[model samples]
Target: MPDHASESSVRPETPEPTGTSKPSRATESKPEGEPTERPESSEAPGMSEAPEFRDAVPSPPQVPAYAQQGRQPQPPNPWQSNRQTTGTLARLRPARPAAIRNATLWAAVATALLSALLLGDGLGPNLLIVAVPAALAAYFAAQAAGRRLRTWSAVWAVGGLALLAVPALRDAGWPTFLAVVSAVALGSLTLHGSRSWLGVFLGSVGLLSSVAGGLRWGMGGVRDRMTGSRGRWGVVFRSTVVAIGLLIVFGALFASADAAFADVLGNLIPDVSLGDAPWRIFLFAVGLVGALTAAYTAAAPVRWDDITIRAGKPRGRLEWALPLIVLNLLFAVFIAIQLTVLLGGYDKVMAETHLSYSAYARQGFWQLLWATLLTLLVIALALRWAPRGQSRDRTLVRTVLGALCLLTLVVVASALRRMGLYVDAYGLTRLRISVAAIELWLGVVLILIMAAGMFGARILPRAVAASAAATVLAFGLVSPDGLIAEQNVQRYRSRHTIDIDYLRGLSADAVPALDSLPEPLRSCALKEIQQTLRTSDAPWYATSWGEVRARDILEKRSANALVANCRGQGSEGGSGRNGVEGDDSYDPY
Candidate 1:
């Protein structure tokens, strides 16, 4: 054999010439892909590990037979150790840890300041109340979001806030303001790459997350050095609580001893008014705490992307087309019947149903409203699994689905007409007006969905959401209360079956509409309105533009009938929103 020999491809139990070899221990220690000795006949001198043509790649970490995979070390925490600000145990890790920490710190500060401002006099004259608080929340949220998500959210937040800030929006009444608030609520999903529904959900939860800031503060501040564990500053907390108790007791004692001493400690003592009052200072403290926590929750959002994304095999083309075809046919028949009814009008409805106009209108309106709501779900599912390929199946599914949306919109129109007829007979109420608004909103959403389907837009849900939000803005601008009142008052002028009791129950928003009434009807309406204004027990914060307008109406022209009608009637706590003569009007608050 040569003096310098290549590593062997074979191993023998015993040496050939010396009749001796090491035990099998050294052979067993070599790992996978290592140059191990194998007993073979046709292998080349240098190709000891495997054949020359076999591909090479790194394998899993080499582990000893005695070592367990479970015992491997974990990765380090992404966030650097911070002694101040924010939760150390992050609810969700941000893409950039440093940016998140800074953002959270700033957000907490902003939230505290907001809490201070709100708890003092509170925010408003409308949107200005929520502006800085909202911006702070948006800013903190933007820190963790990508540029695209932040940008989209910014557009919505700005638009929604600006819409709320309009003076007319306040005058429009609560429904209009609430409608707009719902639209803004959608902006809570301002985090980029999040689903719109998820945003809506988080936005809602964000409203109640006020205590999260305190939790975060506690988390970041509490840590053990020697034991390497987290610990709270409980001793200091208990001591502070005890000290406050002592101060309260001693201050009470000192106050009883001297008037000058009592006066001196006035600034030091807090009058929470733990007495017979319905509300006091501590109530505001609780509210501020909740607001702060909610701000923190918004700022440090836990992404629900993994849970929000539905996982399953989307229905195949055949599966999609089959149900959609059947559904479209049903809708077509319904539409056909609806079309016939539309041309027939009120006379046909009475002849066929043999019911009063209001009864006839009431029965189907509720069902159709439900149908409209249900159809939205059906349309959502069809879009979710709609085939995208340029094939007959995709075309068929799209066409059928679009037809379905159009038909549902027809259903919406029918529902609106029914409600309109009902309202024409009964006059306007809040519930009737709200239902009408919802139906119109549904129709608008269907239209958006149809447009999205035509263009094969992936953002179908978002587009629908945006459209719904826009409709709310539009509804607010038009003002639902004023519209209801105007339409009802006009109906009374034309039909002359005005519900005097119903008009009595109308809110301040309806005052302008009722103001146009003539003589006896005008006196009756003014009487109830005047009583409501004079005896209303709503708090200062609850004061509204409607109240102001109602007050103005009452001041400008006194109603002698109202004074006489309510002469003996007491303004009891049972009066609810209005206290004038038991609020006999049929108007629902």
Candidate 2:
């Protein structure tokens, strides 16, 4: 051992033996993956005694334990995140925040401008046509800039355009214009990928227009959506043949019983109000639309024929029972009508000479026929096109109700005309307008009840019952002959006696109310007031009635009211009394 130690000391002390020996506590205190410790002489003066351990081999500050475990600190995100970062972030983050903020600010400015324009009077109507388009362009631009782009603005814009287009749709070249638009819309649906919204918009437009056109065509040229595949020629030819056959049958019946059926169809079909040339043009346009719809429904890309078409003939009990039930109902209706006519019911129920029970009965026959055909067409279409097991009962019920409404309208029209109110062809009378106002109120209630029914079906039994109740309430409350109705001048004159002198001294608000009273009553009231105002001989007050009346006129806020009074020259009030003897047609002003 002495000889080996002497050799080791002389042989340049082998580094392998020194390294393999256990390190001292001071050297072991440093961690692995660090540089070897330096000599004590290199240390600063009194470093060990100064209570400071200045590290010669320093490592970066150690990460906290929580951070190492990933329990507190987290990886950095390119987007916003509550995390620590050890690397660079995404470049897009900075720009996106500013872009979103700017886009939102622009949207706010546009909305405010739009609101201001709409609130103004002349600007609103003049700009209304272009307002929707301008608004839509701004909305779309902003939406694309925003995080999520909603496509609903596009739908609204198209709807607004349709409303504006209605008045201009009856032009001489309108048919060609419509056809072009329809074709464009239909073709747009074929677009793929990013252009899909364009297709949806165009298709929706075409569909809405088609619905309106179909209604204007009435029942004669209605299309079968499910059977559109057979082509236009086949459908048109079939319709023509049916129309001819019916006309021939009608002619033969008329020849046999001219007296009975002469007046039946006379009123149902109105004469050409716009002259023959225009009427023919109208018919041709209507026919074109009908033909186009039929062709499209028959052969559209979306196959609807498969569901409707049945390869085999029906052999079920339904076929037999349905015809029998229909026959029984027709027979029952005929019997009821005959019985009523024999019991002097016509005399009792008839309201006007123009529109009578006999007229309604005549109209009902054709209406019922048209309605049945329409319902059958809807049923056939639904059966063929709808998914299996989806019933057409709802549609059929709706059609039946529509027929009832038509008949009810005619009956109500006659009743109104009998009460001395002027009614137009579509039953648009002052009484009807009054009823409509009341009906509008009832409609609000109907909506509430319908909403409640969605939650629990027991809220309302049937919509029909509500409709009938509404009609009855309207008839009872708003009818020209109703107990409290102000339609009759005589009733008003008999009820309230207007003090002419007192009214003449009142303000413009009270003067305008005279117009609200029945015409004859207004005439009498104004007459007495004028006599009091114009004459000073028997007057209670000592003032020029004209000066007093002019003062009353100046108090009016309405420009029209002011103009009407100014035109009256304060003598028109007396004219209501002395303009004519007992005639009620004098100016009520």
Candidate 3:
């Protein structure tokens, strides 16, 4: 067969792209290894008999340039267009009924899931609220992809399911971050057969793909089908319009006629402003389209790199290291101060700093936390793209970096110790617990990265990702509230000073732990739990298993005399607010 691509031949079906010059036939190159033309076949052109071959079907006669000019080129196929216009979607779209129904259904499902996640049980707002919907919309959007997307889609789906499985643990801050990262990783793997850093970034972009996907889904054959059915729809549309107008007219008349009937009718059919309908319709249309778009894009993501244009070469190691070196020295000085303070213990800090234990503990923790995170990013960028193979003094740079990372661990430990001391003193809040968990996770990742750096570049990223995920997962497995409650209760038992107000503010996750407190404290805690449970907006269908379990604890308590005892005392300010001067109330912060 002739190498058509290599030859300067143009076929009737394959026109050159617009604006590109056509290859001249005279300048065409002959295929390699072909016998020389035998001195023009020992005959003049057109005068001698033509040579014929049996096996030449693959190599069609090349249309001459003159003949091509006489015969107009066929138009481009919409399906094969490189530019992704709506026609591309029209070509690849599924059946109209299937697309419309499935898109609508999945869109509703996505909205419902959002509602459930938002209004149902939760551990404050985090990544799942955003990511799960994207995953879901992607799941159903890829429904058209069928078996092609089965594995990756399933993995993405499972990751989302895992995220929603434990509501109480959702606030395990590091675990939540890891779970989101895992979901993004899984999404990229499914969408693009990638697990690299680029893949994760693309997965994030894919979340917004739904908007375009929805457009694609709508622009798909559905629009054509709708246009095709417009003749029939026109009559139906006019008739419906007339009917609506008449209904409004008669409804107003009837309402004016019978007040009671109008009241019943009004109850059954709430009034809607025609003025706002367009905006509502617009929003609704956008949501449906966006949902389907997200799904479609997630299922069949466009090549992200094709659109992305990175700017320039990374800064050299020396450029990065010089600044990093300065920071490392500063950190070294800080570490020296920290070690001295550690040796001196709380007493030395008190006398030297003239600050109380809590003040000393809380003093630099937040600043150190930010410093640790910033340093991690700095180290990551420094190690990741800093011309390692080309640099002559890279080993020395790495050793210096390794020492810096090791010193940073002491900073992490200091932060952890400081936070722990503060928590022990002030009792725990959701925010405090989240910070603690994140710091611990950061510490683990630092260790992983430091160790991985020693081995080689190949090991570092994978180890960091894996270790970070594992650390988060481990943290998520333990109910933070339960732990917080246990610690606080222990502190209270030992010191006899519990923060009743703070404990009262905790969510249902703390109920079981708080329940273990002695009578009056337990009663007061149960009242708070019962009130939170009673006032919950989560529908039964949307309730997480953890929430259900929490509710059951409340229900069982209500069934016994426990609820009555609390309720009876609740009116007497069981909240421990109004204490008589001589009264021995169990009120303590």
Error of 2 at 347 (Å): 4.1
Q: Please list the residue runs of candidate 1 whose C-alpha ends up more than 4 Å from where it truly belongs after superposition.
A: 1-127, 137-149, 162-184, 191-193, 196-214, 218-299, 308-319, 345-349, 384-390, 535-543, 561-589
**Candidate 2 C-alpha lDDT tens digits along 327-435:** 4455457546645644566565455444544355434434433443443344333333322222454334334333333333333333333222222211122334444
- Order of all candidates by TM-score, from best down to worst? 1, 3, 2
Can you tell me which runs of candidate 2 are displaced by over 4 Å? 1-107, 113-134, 141-347, 350-431, 434-589
TM-score of 3: 0.59
> Which scores greater on lDDT, model 1 or model 3?
3
Name the lDDT value of residue 539 in candidate 2.
Answer: 15
Task: Choose the strongest candidate by lDDT.
Answer: 3
lDDT of 1 by residue, 396-440 (tens): 766888888888888898899888766765666768877788788
- Cα-based lDDT for every prediction: 0.58, 0.36, 0.59
Model 2, backbone clash pairs (residues 3+ apart or across chains), number: 3
Identify the runs in model 3 with alpha carbons over 4 angstroms from their true place. Answer: 1-157, 168-199, 218-291, 305-329, 384-392, 455-476, 536-538, 558-589
- Arrange candidates by lDDT, descending: 3, 1, 2
